[model samples]
Target: MKLQTQVPLNKATNQIDYSSQLVVLGSCFANNIGDKLAYYKFRALQNPFGILFHPLAIENLISRAIQQKQYTEEEVFFLNERWQCYDAHSDLSSVRKEELLGSLNSGLLETKLWIAKASHVFITLGTAWTYQLKESGKEVANCHKVPQMVFKKQLLSIDRIVQGLKDMLHLIQAVNTKVKIVLTVSPVRHLKDGFVENQQSKAHLISAVHQIIKTGNATYFPSYELMMDELRDYRFYGNDLVHPNDLAVNYIWEKFKTVWISETSYKTMDEVAAIQKGLDHRPFSQESEKHKEFLKTLGNKITNLQKEYPFMKF
Candidate 1:
């Protein structure tokens, strides 16, 4: 008898192989999946401007990138000895103003280039809650630890989220018509918003995503459902009990692989995994003949894989 309920998933029509170029965006969970893809040496560009959580923030970045908008000094502010842009994550903040502007503008260009040729774009929506800067009357991707009183916190309405997502789809499709957009709600709980409030935030995201996917312009992956149902236990959570632990991430990734990754790539993936494990192996004796032989074998594996996929680097 089945003890746990599983979220049923169907294989995607356009599966991802090594040849596919991917762009992964939105939320820290996006990084979890993106990191997995990267570890396996797939061609993936992830969160160029950094981890953005809400739909409106994501839309703002995509809109600017597609338009080739440049960030100016007036757009960035100095705070706590670091320059910051409300439109991007704190990870992009820099000690120098010019450095911050340069990074932001370059990120826009990189995003445009990747999105234009990406075979698959995975967008993971983290929350519907957003903070609007009172001075500019605009939503900010990250607050960068600015005084809480300066911003107004708001929960984006389902209608507003739907419109933002639609705008994103329109913007991306304008550049690359054949790109397949896959949307998923991040399973990481935003408990800092309060438990009930977090549920409300997730609800709004889920509703808006479903509304958009019904049009067949995109597809939804049940990542949130998988975490909540299939791996519904505290053991699957990190110490904070908010984010999925490595095991949970791996479990979700396996499910994702089954549905989204091409079966033909499996043998190659296994070979890559073996090489990765070999690379990570630490020999007890550094100068031993056995260790030397192991290193030689590892080097040959890397060379062979690189010959096949020149883009792959150890």
Candidate 2:
């Protein structure tokens, strides 16, 4: 008998191989998958702007990037002695104003170029709730620790979410008509929104995503279902019981590889994984002959792989 009810996933028609260029953007779960691709030495650019939680925020960023819009000085403000842009994550906030501006502008250009050439763009939606700045009536990606009074919290309707995703798809296809989009809802629970509210938020996201998927402009991955169903135990969760632990992430990633990644690239991926594991190995006897031999072997492996794929970096 089957121990777990597995989500039935078909192999993607547009499979990702080592040659494919990828751009992953959206929630923190995007980071998890992006890092895995990076670890496997795939050419991937992930969340250049930062970790955006909601679909509208993600759409806003993608729209701006496609338009090559520059972030002006007026768009950012000094808060707690640091310069912050409401459109970006707190990690992009900087102590120096010029540094923040340069970074934002550079990131926009990079992201625009990446999307235009990317074979696959993975977008993970985290929630349907968003915060709008009351003064400008603009939806902000991150509040940046601003006082709660300055922002109005709102739950986006399914219609609005669907429209935003469609807009994002249009914007992307306008630049790169053939790009394949893989959309997934993040499994990380936002219990801070209250359990019931969190469920409502996820429901809105799930509904909107499925609508978009039906358009054939994108494909849907059952990441949320995988976590909620197959790995339903608390052991799969982090200490907060919100985010998936490392093991859970790995499990989901393995499932993703089977469906989304090209079968022909499996051997290459294994080779890459071996090289990565070797690089990560810590030797207790750095001066020993055995350790020196291991280093030589590792160097040879890197050299051989780099010969085949010149773009790879350790």
Candidate 3:
């Protein structure tokens, strides 16, 4: 008897190969999958503005990037001796306003270029819940430790989420028509919103994603279903009990590979994995002949791989 239910994922019509340039956005889970892509040395740009959990934040960023709109002083504010942009994650915040502006503009330009050429775009929506700045009456991607009283907490309606996703796809397709968009509700639970509320938030996100898929604009990856049904045990959870642990992430990634990644790339992925492992190996005797030999072998392996994949970097 089968102990667990499996998500039936059909092979994608358009598979990801070395030639494919990937752009990943939205949520911490997006980073998790993007990290796997990076590990295999795939050409991927992930979350340039950092983890955006909700659809509106993602929509806002995409609009700004495609429009080539530059961020100004009004969009950024000085807080706790540091400058912060409500549109960006705290990861992009800096002590110097000029540095922050430079980073944001550069990232926006890079993201615009990435979207223009991306073969596949993966979006992982984390929650339906969002916070809007009360003063500006605008939704904030991240509060950046701003006082709670300054924002109005709310859950996005299903209609709004669907509309935001449609806008995101329209903006992307305007720049690149051939891009295949994949949408997934992040398996990571936002329990801080309260357990029941978290479930409601996830339900809303899942519903919105399906609506997008039904319209033939995107495909759905059953990441949330896989986590909930296949890896139902607590062992799949991280120490925080909200995020998936490394093993769980790997499991989901393996499933992703079977469906999305091209089978022809497996051999190259093996070579890349071997090189990664060799590079990560710690030598006890750096001056020893064996260590030197190992280094030479590793160098040769990298050289061979780079010859085949000139874009690959060690």
TM-score of each: 0.98, 0.98, 0.99
Please provide, for model 3 over 1-314, each residue's C-alpha lDDT reduced to its tens digit, 9 standing for 90 to 100: 98898888899989999999999999999999999999999999999999999999999989999999999988899998999998999899999999999989998999999999999999999999999888879999999998999999999999999999999999999999999999999999999999999999999999888989999999999999999999999999999988999999999999999999999999999999999999999999999999999999999999999999999999
Best by TM-score: 3
lDDT of 1: 0.95
1-314 in candidate 2: lDDT tens per residue?
A: 87898788888898999899999999999999999999999999999878999998899889989898999999999999999998899889899999999999999999999999999999999999999989889999999899999999999999999999999999999999999998999999999999999999999999999999999999999999999999999999999899999999999999999999999999989999998899889989899999999999989999998999999999
Assess candidate 3 and give its TM-score to the true structure: 0.99
Query: Per-residue CA lDDT of candidate 1, range 1-314, in tens?
Result: 98999898999999999999999999999999999999999999999989999998899889999999899888999998999999999999899998999999999999999999999999999999999989879899999899999999999999999999999999999999999999999999999999999999999999999999999999999999999999989999999999999999999999999999999999999999999999889989999999999999999999998999999989
lDDT of 2: 0.94
Candidate 2 lDDT at 44 equals 96
Backbone clash pairs for candidate 3 read none
Q: What is the clash count of model 1?
A: 0
Q: Least accurate stretch of 10 residues (summed lDDT) in model 2?
A: 1-10
Q: How many pairs of residues collide in model 2?
A: 0
lDDT of each: 0.95, 0.94, 0.95
Q: Which runs in model 3 stand beyond 4 Å of their true positions?
A: none
